[model samples]
Target: MFEKFRKKSVVSESSQLETLREVLRRNPEDNDLAKVFPQVMPLSAVSSAWPGPIERLGDLPFGVSWALADPQNYFRYVSWDMSRKWEASGTNWRGLAMENLTELSRRYPYAGSKKGADGRPFVLSLLNEDSMGPSRLLVPGLFQDLFGDDYIVAIPERTCGVAYRNGLVGEEALLANDLIDGCFKVGTEPMSNERFDPKRFWVL
Candidate 1:
């Protein structure tokens, strides 16, 4: 009788997990997840258990210097209006829109928009880190919402290899490199005298 009870408990738990996964898969933008599972908010729980290399402040210098020195490779022109903001911020390029994971999934379910030269499938996630943890739900949810039709679901990894075959870098490689060298420049102030001035340059 005890053995039967244990089996039933295991099945129930598995079913619950699957149900949660399905919900997240269908609704990546459900902010209510935090209410349902408060511990998953702020991403601290996931970050703590992340199985990636520890981030160090020293790494910032390399990424910052590289970006500052090579404006062409690092910067991309988004639009005339956005260029002004980028100039004001003293940055020429924008990193992948991490905050727009849900939108990206909604628009490009299989891969990123076809209008671009780089036809890579845009990666989406909630947790900013590239590691195995609870916060990892953000990525899987984004993937399911966006590319569920084309990609396979894999926990922890949160990316589908077959769906990303044409991408420039695999999800793991992107995570590893991004963790090692990527920097988030949101809401940072531009240094005095370092702001870009488009008015100073004329289009020939």
Candidate 2:
């Protein structure tokens, strides 16, 4: 489903340069720029690097790894799906004791009852580039426009936003995702089926 769509945008090279400048401006004293922008730029930097619809990822988790691998591969957001690793492990990964996250999404990206100390329910939402407004920018506001307050983590390149209900923040939700027994990570979001065109500013 995700593969069928194409996100079109004429990225202004100048705009990207400006965006990077703005982010670096936050900390002018840092002598080493590499320290600030690590191997995989933090989720926050991804938001800041582009001057598009989505300018920032407010409180997303740290597990996200979307950095510009090679300048030649411009406009491509390098993605490493932890879930895919499990998918490769066969039943050992997919057959976890948890719910079939993929199946739950078939109906509605809703939540279940409170399970942990935080008294929160796991919530999942999707932010799609095809459905996103004209700019193809995965803006933070887009999550609110779509799933309201239930969203947790958002993968802009994949164009999917995940959330956990109640007060369970991204960290807690991700923790629960790992700790819960018999829990299978849901394949609801479009982590796959994406191709990034190096020549273009858009990832299709």
**Best-fitting candidate, measured by TM-score?**
2
Residue 193's lDDT within candidate 1 is 15
Model 1 lDDT tens row, 24-84: 3453232211111101111121222222111211211100100011112221112233334
lDDT computed for candidate 2:
0.31
RMSD of 2: 18.5
Instruction: Evaluate all candidate structures by whole-model CA lDDT and list the values in order.
Output: 0.26, 0.31
lDDT of 2 at 155: 33
lDDT of 2 by residue, 1-204 (tens): 233224445356567557655553453232221111111122343444443222223232212222221223233222223234434656332222112222223333322233445443454334322222111222223224443544444233333433334345566656534422112123222232222221121221
TM-score of each: 0.20, 0.22
Pairs in clash, predicted candidate 1: 75-92, 75-93, 76-93
Global local distance difference test of model 1: 0.26
